[model samples]
Target: MRTRLAAVAENFGRDLDAAYATIDRLLRRARAEGTGLIALPEACLGGYLSSLGSAEDRGTAETRRQRSGPPALALDGPELRRVQEMARDVVVVLGICEDGGTDRYNTAVALTGDGVLGVHRKVHQPLGENLSYAAGSTFEAFETPVGRIGLQICYDKAFPEAARTAALDGARIIVSISAWPGARTAAAADLAQDRWKKRFDLYDQARALENQVVWVASNQAGTFGSLRFVGSAKVVGPGGDVLADTGVDTGVAAADVDVEAELDAARRAMFNLRDRRPDVYGALVREPAHA
Candidate 1:
């Protein structure tokens, strides 16, 4: 079946209620445009921290408290229940701060009317993110109405092993939700010209090409406190082509394609996953020299 998917690039402040309302509005827009699977920005449930402990932040104790991020919620929390209700028609993959027992995790979950399909606790931490949440241990893909889908939060996509593990586990599509920002030092007059935007686009294409899988990338947009996000949400085909994109703006980027057929076509040439490579790549697991 030819399916339509979207990656949303937008801003959501530190208000959970406001975030819910924003999601409600986006869902309506996506449904109207016939999007079947939608990927939302990281921390879309509320908002990411103003500063990930940048030197500009005040007292260490206070910065730690503030950067801890939105109020964490349980799997069956009211916020998600409301989303589950609204997700009756399409599948949604988005990020949130998860409250489980005594620990908080940087988590992403895929949901539908049938309830949660899969959940991924972000495994990689960048900058001061480790101060805020617990790291996940594994990467596994799950079956959904869309296809065998895998979830990866920001920073995880930077490591080739992350997506390769998912593709090896039978994932046909991977969604990476991020709160990525532009160059912190080189302030560009135009956000689109930011160097980080170039890196973001490169990673999305490389990951898709190497895995021969559909890639959906969503990110936060606009400025939030000290951070200015580079909104470059996009969907990449199995052959590393950008199918749709929202460059430096807050909007939904959608594309319609036969995902399985694309994957098959891409794999027919190289069979990237089928070609065994583990025996020659033990160095990947070893400690590396600092640059």
Candidate 2:
């Protein structure tokens, strides 16, 4: 049973109404295309950080105040409810700045018309991200109508362990949502040539190949504040081949794949999971010794 999956590459901002409108339009298109699952970019509800680095790095007290970060939304808030209504039957995965009482988290959620099926708080915070949000402690795979799926936010994909952990927990598909920006210094004239863009694409392929799972990557497009995004949304097969891609533009990358068949074929020859030597890898869990 082949299922159609779509990964979106489009810009979203602080305006909730505008974001909702974009989401509504995307959902409509996915429905028309008969997409079973759709993945939206990180911070698709509000937006990502206007800039990386710390407030002190930018200088000026007013500049620091301006970088306070995106609106913190509750998991059960009306904002998500609206998305749920729009989702209806499609399994939608997207990111948000979660309001966790005293703390704020960079979170991703998988949902349908029924309600949220799974949630993941980004465990790895890059640059000065920790200043804005608290770190998550685990990578979990949960059951959804689409399949056993896992979620990862920007920066989370940089760590191989993040995706590997989810695969070990039985995830057949991984949706990685990112608001990834291009090189800040000496950037390429063509976004396709950007180093960060290359890294972003490489991570998607490597993670899928290693886990032998379907990979869907979504990212922000165009500019937001001082940051310029790469916008290379794509879908990768278990063999690490790109099934569909939006390139360096705003569009949806859609692919039809029978997830179970692909995984079975990839694992049949060299079953990485079954060949694991857990006893010899004890150092993986040890705390690093700082100089």
Candidate 3:
């Protein structure tokens, strides 16, 4: 019933050694702490530099090694196998540039002892990502020994449908891995001020409060080229409380997440699925106003 989850706000740029080292550290720490689930930033294995151009760009053996190489193996490649070795009864979720047959995807990989559960391709690939990645088509919940977990990437969290579907499908914890550009933070703060902060700020909090499930996000930190990844990786409870968070540097955030508590809150809460008027909602969707 009680699960401890860890999120590492990592730096994923052009350095693969640093990235791998960061993951290694997090794995050791999570194991020592007996963390049930560990989540790493988007592109944690490599960095956010994974794109068609970078993957194809001819470079030295070292340069080629740094790139996510061929995208196809992004999900089940040697890099993941190395990472999987670090798994010690803890479910590790990390992001990678996924390759799907003919196209590439910004995907998040979930791994446990049994093996890789499934890959959740970023449904809503953002601006720069759209150029190099394909959008994900399917949505489903994953059943793990830790609990019923669901995976999502950065931009996908901005949409309500994905989280709602995850919740409706019985996901106790919604894990989102992101590389959200930090450039928007200041502009967003200037626009919304402290009242709202970032545009996706509401989305992060709402995903937990609305779905009545634990919302955990693993985000990038530090600088990647011109982008400054915000390191506010957080764990929000079903009651909308931030259980744990980290500063704007490479670090880890963790908290005790209870599935039974989330389920209890969802059932007892009046605004969740139990209180929804599906019949009326169906009618509203069926009858559209004249445009």
Rank the models by lDDT, top first: 2, 1, 3
**Tens digit of per-residue lDDT, candidate 1, span 50-144:** 77658744454335655545878788988888998878878999888898676778899999988999999999998777767779988999999
Model 3 lDDT per residue over 1-291, tens place: 678988777777655677678778888889898899988888776567533233354555345444454334556567788778878578999888775676777788889766798678888865445555668876689898788888999878887879988888888888989886654333443322432225446677888998888888888876665566667788888877778887555678899877787668656746586676676667444645664
lDDT score for candidate 2 against the true structure? 0.92
In TM-score terms, candidate 3 sits at: 0.84
Worst 10 residues of 3 by lDDT: 188-197
Every candidate's lDDT: 0.89, 0.92, 0.74
Query: Considering summed lDDT, which 10 consecutive residues are worst modelled in model 2?
Result: 56-65
Candidate 2 C-alpha lDDT tens digits along 1-291: 999999999999999899999999999999998999999999998898888883444654334435656898999999999999999999999999998987888899999999999999999988767767788998999999989999999899999999999999999999999999999889999999999999999999999998889999999999998889999999999999999999999999999999999999999997877888999998788887872
TM-scores of all candidate predictions against the true structure = 0.95, 0.95, 0.84
Q: How close is candidate 1 to the true structure, as a TM-score?
A: 0.95
Clash count, one per candidate? 0, 0, 0
Q: Arrange candidates, best TM-score first.
A: 2, 1, 3
Clashing pairs in 2: none
Top-scoring candidate (lDDT) = 2
